[model samples]
Target chain A: MTGDVIASRDNPRIKRLRRLAHEGGAYRREGQVWVEGDHLCAAALAQGHRPEAVIVTPAGMHWVERWRREGGLAADVPVWTVTDAVMGHISPLESPPSVACLLPLAEGTSVRPDVPTVVLDRLQDPGNVGSILRSAAAFGFAQVIALRATAALWSPKVLRAGMGAHFGLHLVEGADAAAVEALRVPLIATSSHQGAWLHTARLPWPCAWLFGHEGQGVDLRWMARATTTVRIIQPGGQESLNVAAAAAICLHASAVSAFGGL
Target chain B: MTGDVIASRDNPRIKRLRRLAHEGGAYRREGQVWVEGDHLCAAALAQGHRPEAVIVTPAGMHWVERWRREGGLAADVPVWTVTDAVMGHISPLESPPSVACLLPLAEGTSVRPDVPTVVLDRLQDPGNVGSILRSAAAFGFAQVIALRATAALWSPKVLRAGMGAHFGLHLVEGADAAAVEALRVPLIATSSHQGAWLHTARLPWPCAWLFGHEGQGVDLRWMARATTTVRIIQPGGQESLNVAAAAAICLHASAVSAFGGL
Candidate 1:
């Protein structure tokens, strides 16, 4: 059943949702993330995540009810109605969504050595981080480890950029390089300079790919741990590729190589 | 010689620079774009762009002088020093750069029919537009045609996302689908559904790539003109890849195939 309307911006729960939307690290402290829009909510449900609560604007009530009828939303979950102005206050986007939900952050999982994983080392851009997650998920890398300085994976910007990939990923944030080193799979570092060409190289499948900060390449500690380094050849002579672009090219190459012979 | 320091944010030139930084279409109105940071400035110079003027903070004077000595800046171009606060006021970035330049926009060029080209069809994200530009430049696609509904190619955000690839590109914005249809090379449309897998397809070298809006895939009008449609396979079952990521993979694949036998 739906709960009472929360029309006030001053409501304590609304304030917390607003915080979660604006601050990346707030999710860590509050133990929940605010996922906006029906696409993301459906994705979370598809991934078997139970929303702690759903907040919808008056105009969105019909859509939420439709979702409930379609089994996209749980019948038992409480839905709170908020005024359009209150929805705007809680949204971080320029165009506020009609609906949003508070979902608990998945419990942190240890790196699984045998499974393919992606290690993000101090990536600062939320878009790049989220894009990489989507690429990783698309290419069969089921796990992602974000090193200490990486953007908060649950941040609203990242969630929006991730485009629902977050629901399917086993994301480990604020991880140490040491934790990554403990994984048994071979680590592959991507370099813009001084490595065998990726297209020509014999890449390792089920390996851990280490992507770094925008300005900095993979850290020395991570580089030292790399079983091999690969470079994407730029025949047209641009200095380097964008980090997210680089990740997709590398991941797709790996995926193709892995599946090409089968 | 360096001109007088601008300590006041109200200075006419500084106000214009701030406008150029914050507004997407300001470059079109003012006939100039502000390029911030040394990397972008150097890239512009390397591409034979003549800066109308150079603006730097007090601490950045030495670097500008060195650039001048090295011939990165033209001797006749006026150099103005601004206080750090004034510099901040002229920058849209969270961290302001010490140096920036007011460079005249390249005269609008018509889409060259013979050159390898990338067409933007109502793509709105500044970063995606920029990233695709970088991929185009890196893959030897020297011309980019942005359809009328696409994001402003010369905008500050797109320029920054482009990472200096703008200097090397022949970009035509506010273009129509008919202009793209007139290109001599085969038009390749990227689709998330119902197309040959990109990796397995025989991609044409120096063809035109049509990238579409983030939410709406390539328009049917453009799709109808396509000689072929290619899809990037996603073994991991995601619906689609980010447009930028898709561009990189497709471009890089074309590059490799073109150069592989040579």
Candidate 2:
């Protein structure tokens, strides 16, 4: 399934790839997400996903061959070789990776009602959204629901920040309060003030933790749905914690309670 | 101490302030740091630090007067009123803040020997550095030491990311491993692999935790100095945790242990 080498940066496939890399919402329109670097590609493959197409530099051709031999890539996957200049044109990073792939967005999955979950309410930073996803996956939160105003879950920057956590979890983006309300588990909202101290509180093991926007916290509509609200105590008295840091602390607390001492 | 309104962007003071906003190391050369927003300015004043000068938009003049009335700003501090155009020229944010101030970089402080501390080993992201500082301060890590290779501690981005955490902690930047070695308490290194599980370990109350670069773990040189190494158990099996997320978990664990259930 090898294609003719795309020498021109303006090739249709190359232009689409560039759009996918640069536009946060392109995946929603194109039906595929672009992922760069070997680690992400390998992670997708390890999760039983086959790339629709792979773009590689001439120098990366050997690495792709190694992947096929090692069972990290499929032989039938379309492979396109490109010049350094073309690769640069499609890259979103300052230092471009050696290879990249287009993975079809997994069809939207319904949120499982009883499993541990994380609900992101209008989180704007790609880094924060991705970091929360990573923590959710690491701490046994099997599903992530991102509200409509949140940064696009499949954006390249979020993918890089997630560091391969995307493939392992059920990620539902453009979700609304109704989707969150449908969950059977207790909804826990994190606040910097106006709740029980996190450490002393008995966090529900299989619960949905709601983290909100950088400045305005959980939306008032969603806050009305939360069964419990907890605040990470700031003993030193800074106004608030970074949302990603707060998510990590809250998720780890639940993990600790469930696993019983690490 | 009010200066005549400076209407030109080419003014030397305005040019220097713009450089301080854009350049990471400009504070080191300019002998001052730039802070925007009411929260950070109020935090600095609460810490008993005086501003050398306060720059405000015409609309912000009334706010500055209120600050003076409330004693958040000294009556004698130089105040420069700039038009909206000049304010935009000096601002790094897309939405320019109404006001900003110049605070002298306090002379570098030495890491206190026996207090809870955080040693940053070449961590490059300003957001990560600032978030870590917020966590350290919240969890009772009274001091932070950044290795020479780390991001500039007083840089505008770091200052913004810190969210007023900078004023609350003793920060030492451009420090060498020698500075870390002088700490009398046991040094702890956090790794994704190879050590006791962080939750189960009896963490030292006043220990120093070494966090490293985004891609690189702590440098091998400092690993030799670690009295204990701990790993946060990842139940879902992601390869590693984000540095700031890891720091929050580790610091919170130590805080819980020391403070006896916050």
Candidate 3:
């Protein structure tokens, strides 16, 4: 059934939605995050995370009503129609989508690391996290371990950056360095300072590709245990690469070395 | 000289800074954008784009005052010391920086035809734009051209993602297909559907690398004019790559092929 359309900015539910959409810790505090646009909404639904409520702009009301008629949103679930201005006020993106839904955090499943893995160390940027996830999915990394201090994997910004790839992967956040050390495969670290040139280096198959913090790079402690540290030879003048770019190249090389058979 | 610490949110200058930070067009309308944190502020000074005014948090004021005494900010520039909460109101990043400065737009420059270049077609995300800029800078690409639909290169989000590479590269935006054709160089196109595998393909040196839309890819019209079309062999499960990831690969491949001294 439809809840009354909310036009007022001060509506408690609307305010809560705004907080969940804009602020950082809302996901942890509320145990929910806003999923926007039709594709991401569909992705969440397909994954069986039912919407607590569906919010739509005036132009989007026809579809929302049709969804109700088709028994798409649960009978008990509420649908709130908001004005475009209010929608923009709550959107994390530049252009607010016509529809944004409230979806519960999908519980983290046991990470069964069957294929090659990626270990992120203190990677700070959400965009980097998202890009890494997309690359990891593309290259068929079995799991992504987000070490403590790395950006939250499920944050709205990261979700948008990942472009629905998050739904398909096994991602663990706040993973300790020791936990990464415990993985079954060899940990191949990437650094600019010391390592064999990646192109000529013989990369091991089915190894864990270790990528470190954006500024600091891989911690020295982990470097001590690295099975091998590889470097992308830079002939150009720039000193180093953006960490996410490095991750993509390293992971792709790993995929290539494995004959991309996994 | 320092101004009365701006205590009210409705102060005209504060409102203007907030607008510039959040709204993209504010830069064009007001001829300025809010550049936050020490690095960007330092970069602006280095590039000779002096700040019109600065607002610093109490903690920020200490270092900023020292910088001002050391001739960091322009002599005539006004400094407004404020609380961290006030700075947070105008910051685009998750955490508010210690200082925020409003800087005017840099003068425009044309893309020189005879240089290794990168062309972005309809790449909509800002972070991707920033990453591509970083890649372009790293791989010795002389210029970066963004199609009209691509995210603005100097937009705060893009600048932040670029980590100051924007200032280092010649960036041109609002480009058209015809304009891209105007550049008299061998255009190398990247595609997943049809092309020689990039690794084995003979790529021309000092060429322009053209990467197309994320979903649709380089337009057919552009592809027809491509001197060579190269594809990355993805032996894994994915159908295609993230455009930025593909761009990095193609650009790096081009660099290697061009300059590897075969």
Candidate 4:
């Protein structure tokens, strides 16, 4: 389904793409998430996610072949050749990318219990949220639950930071405490002040790591449900680490401990 | 040395403060580094750094008393009270902070060999550089060397990402490959492919973990000089982890393996 070159900025399809690129919550309304660049598109395809459409510049048509070589970039998927200006109109990045794809957002997503998980509790920064997602995906945490107060999971900033981890993850956005409580795995809440040191703690496998807001630790009400509290040892006597860094260390610990080093 | 209320934005001292806050390279020219908020001020004080001047808003006077309670804030340090408008004029932050301090930048700093250290080789992102700095400090890597191609180490963005780790570090910025070669310890270069898995390696106690540019990775010349090349085992089958996350995982491995779980 090859679409003709779309040059007009006011095209209905272009307007929708603009909203998805700029607005953080637009994907929920549009039912499609826009992923820019080839790496992300390849990653999504690798996870068996077929894009609804692929948008590219005339010069960027080379990427179509590259994407096709990487995964099943289906022949039937709509390929919209657009002008360079139109590419910029639909891109949130400073230097507009050559290719991008619109993938249908999954509906009715639910948490998978008894699996490695990472939960974001009212975490603010998009960079922090996204970085944690990469760590989770890298360390075998297939499910990520973002509490209602957390940054929008599909936002452009977060998607970029996640770097294609989104496709491989079972992400439950806008989840509440009730939904989190439904998880069968033990909840391991991370604390900066008091908790079992991560290095020495006997970390449980298939557990959910609950990371909290930047300013405040885990909510007291949420903290009450935790099976154990863990803290990373700052041997340098510094106060604490950035949340993403802490998440990486903790998640890696579980991966190495439970499965042994690869 | 209590300076009286100065409300004018055009004041010579105010202009210098504005430059330091806004321009990333201004600290080098002015020979002073401006730090904002009580948290950073306390961190500097904890490291026995006496600010040349402490600028505060009229209502922000409470911070001066609070900072004085923290490690040796000093009696003779200049505490300059300014109008709220003047505070806004000098601040680089979105919401103007109540207190900021100007500390003299160190001169003629050199590398310390035979210590747990991190080497940033031409890393582009400020957030990545700063995050690495935090991980290095947290894991007891007391020395950090930023190659000439790396991001400006003392920039405001890097400073914010670093949290308060700058005070605890022996930072050597703007160094060439020659300077890095002078280091006595083993040079541990990190790679995404073709390296020993980090978990199984017998990591040295006081080696330099050389991290490279986010996109290009470690330079070939630098890699050639590496005593050992290490890579983190990504259990989830993801292509790779982010550079900062990789650094955190690698640094923590050295920390825990050598110290035996702190």
Regions of candidate 2 where Cα sits further than 4 Å from its true position = A1-3, B1-3
Give me the runs in candidate 1 sitting further than 4 Å from their true place: A1-3
Q: Rank the candidates by lDDT, best first.
A: 2, 1, 4, 3
Please identify which of the two predictions, 1 or 4, would achieve the higher DockQ against the true structure. 1
Cα TM-score per model: 0.97, 0.97, 0.75, 0.95
Root-mean-square deviation (CA) per prediction: 1.6, 1.6, 5.7, 2.1
The docking category that best describes candidate 2 is medium
Weakest 10 consecutive residues, lDDT, candidate 1 chain A? A105-114
The worst-scoring run of ten residues by lDDT in candidate 2 chain B lies at B253-262
The CA lDDT of each predicted structure is 0.87, 0.88, 0.76, 0.86
Best by DockQ: 1
lDDT of 2 by residue, A1-262 (tens): 4566788987899999999999999999999999998888888888888999888988788779988998978888989999888999999788888898999998867777889999999999898888888888888889999888999999999999999999988988888767887899999997766788888888887999999999998899999899999877676665578899999999988988887553
Interface RMSD of each: 1.3, 1.5, 2.3, 1.4
Q: Mind sharing the TM-score for model 1?
A: 0.97
Candidate 3 per-residue lDDT over residues A154-195, each given as its tens digit: 788888777776766677777875577568788899877778
Chain B of candidate 4 achieves a TM-score of: 0.96
Q: What digit string (tens of lDDT, one per residue) describes model 1 on residues A1-262?
A: 4657778999998999999999988999999999999888888888888999999998888878887888878888888899889999999888899988999887766767678889999999999998998898898888899999899999999999999998888888889856786788888998777788888888888888999999987889889889999988787785578899999999998888787552
Off by over 4 Å in 3: A1-114, A154-157, A234-236, A260-262, B2-15, B46-90, B258-262
Interface RMSD of 3: 2.3
TM-scores of chain B, in order = 0.96, 0.96, 0.87, 0.96
List, for all models, the DockQ compared with the true complex. 0.69, 0.63, 0.33, 0.65
